[model samples]
Target: MDLASQIYERKSCRNYLDEEIDLDIIKDFISKCRPLNENINYYYEILTKDEVSVRTPWSAPYYLALYSEEKENYFENIGFVFQQVSLFLQSIGIGSCWVGMASPKKKKSNFVILIAFGKSEKMTRDRSSFKRKDLSKISDYEDERLVPAQLAPSAINSQPWFFKHSKDGFDVYQKKQNILKRQVFKNWNPIDMGIALAHLYVENEETFDFEIKNDFEELKGHTYTGSIKI
Candidate 1:
């Protein structure tokens, strides 16, 4: 399936079937793509058998452990890259959840994120409501069209970010906040924005026949600064 369909078809699958995924499945997926940034790597690493822990029953047999040494941008990258992985898994009929609320098994890195993978337990439509915003609500008509940017995922579903149109393409930005991060919450907003860019560009290309050109630029009232053009 295309990335945009994958993005829209993807949902947070908290309830998974009691199924285990082959290690090779995840390994092959990660091995194929290199992350855009070097300070961090984006792929699922097999933790020790003990690395899998949870209060509730986990659906997918495998859980991916996200790790990074970058103090300010690790989680951002996790959010960014994992979103892509999440959608990819969905494309293949695998269920996943961005398991930030669960207790992580490893503690060696400055930041960490996790996603539970498995076959999903079927649910009614009412139980699967992931109400996303429309194109008009996220940006103004003159505002470089940020409709696709709203598809991004954030901490506890708190998509704390913003977007602005630039002379070049579109500038994806974040909102600065004094909110506290647990020792585990090493800031990952920039990387998340990068993943967000992936979704925006992918969806735009498939649906609108547009492509994004990345050009770094600075803007006010936004967190990290990046751009992609059509």
Candidate 2:
């Protein structure tokens, strides 16, 4: 299926069978995802553990962790890189979830994205049941479609973003309400925001060009979050 359809059909998979992904499969997956930045790519590595202990929102059999050593914006790179892996897994009939908080005992891995494999399970409504605000409510478009921005994943699916539009383009900003801190991985709000921006850009590649706004204030507070034009 196409990327747009994959985005729509992709749901967080939290169940896995008693199976192991071959080392070759993992390598092949990475081969497909040539990193955009060489430096950031060098700082990240994918690790897997069979005996992983996880708590809330996850019941998958096995877990995968992407390890990063960068001090700043490393976790964000984790989100950005793993999103690609998760989408690739989905394309190959696998399921995944952003399990950053699920694995509490992980080392050198602050962010954990869960993937559920094997047979497909029953589809259920998302726990949030919160209605997706229409494009009219969150965007400035006359033709209403679920703007891919709404589909961007958050730290815990909190979806912490607000919208502002102008003659040039629209802006996405992060809200600092009820923010949660990561134990091992620091600096994720902006990183996740960047991941969300990547999704929005991939989904709307032809529509606009993404530009990183130099807002010193938003960048100052670690809790503050949001996106700018693209």
Candidate 3:
């Protein structure tokens, strides 16, 4: 199975087994992950159970800790880049989860987020099982191209993304949050938007073009993230 195909079947795995994967092979795959923004410098560290604390339904054998240089859209850059790792894991019969409620025991200035992954029993699911917003809810109009983003996972199921059609393509935005929701998701929201974009790129690897837009029309309740053509 390919990463693009796994998008429909992939879920936040909560049934990890006590097993180890070949670290060498995993490192190689991570080295080749598509970078939505290559200009942002980033690296990964494989940590064991001893290195971090996780509050989740399942425990993982290893956590892939992402560290990136801070810059505009860096959070989204990490989200866009590492999501491919999650999808790739599922394609190879491993399971993974994005653990926002996790922290490293020895936190560094650049540490961004954790991707908890490990061995699991291979599972199968279909589109009917997806819990997501309707196509119309995510965009001004229904678009088949936006299906991948519709099903993309966000922290606590926030699904904080919106799309607007453009003359050439479309623009992406992070949906604005209220005061209460903002407090809970201020940091995670940009990262979540990146994950949504990753789905579009993974499915359309050949022609995924992402660029910052300065002259974009302002959305009433959303922050412009980027422009996309795919």
Candidate 4:
């Protein structure tokens, strides 16, 4: 299937079979996976259940642990890189889910996120099965280009991104976190923005120049994250 098809068909799988993935295939995927930013230092390890601590009830036989040297846009970098891995796994029939609620008990580096992957009981989902905010709700301009971005996954399905048309392309922002939610999601929201960016990149191979402009006016409850020039 094509990349667009993979974006629409991929779904998070919570239940996984107790089977080991082929080491060769895993290595090949690692070699082929691309990161959004090449300048940052990031590391990943394929781990078994015994190597990590997960408080959630969902379980998978194999997990991919991601770590990065703390730097600017580190969380977003993690999301950008792993979302590629997630989409690739779905494209090849392996099941994967972003395990943000879980963490490694032993810290070798700055653990950013974990992905659980293995044989899943159910492999794919129809495009209509996606539970996402409508395009009208997510974007200021009426363009199909933003549809894939609307479907980008987030922690607690927050769907925290907003977009407005600009002369060159678009300006991206994150919804202002209310007091009740800020304490829990301050870090995860930027990661969600990165996931949306990955979807946008897959939809259109355009260059994006990220910047923070506090003076840029935004929707009533949103804050500026960055911009993309088409």
TM-score for all models, in order of appearance: 0.73, 0.68, 0.96, 0.89
lDDT of 3 at 72: 89
Question: Against the true structure, whose TM-score is highest?
Answer: 3
Model 3: lDDT equals 0.89
Give the CA lDDT, 0 to 100, for residue 25 in model 2.
Answer: 73
Candidate 4 global Cα RMSD? 2.3
Clashing pairs in 2: 76-191, 172-227, 173-226, 174-225, 174-226, 209-230, 210-230
Per-residue alpha-carbon lDDT of model 3 for 80-162, expressed as tens digits?
98898888888888888888888788978898899988887754578899899999999999999999999898989999999
Q: What lDDT does the true structure give each of the candidates?
A: 0.57, 0.52, 0.89, 0.80
**Model 1 compared with the native: what TM-score?**
0.73
lDDT of 1 at 190: 52
How do these models rank on lDDT, best leading? Answer: 3, 4, 1, 2
- Model 2, which residues run further than 4 Å from truth? 32-49, 104-106, 109-119, 122-131, 136-146, 166-168, 179-191, 206-209, 215-230
C-alpha RMSD (angstroms) for model 3: 1.2
Model 1 per-residue lDDT at 208: 25
Could you tell which candidate, 2 or 3, scores higher by lDDT? 3
> Which ten residues in a row are the worst by lDDT in model 2?
216-225
lDDT of 2 at 172: 56
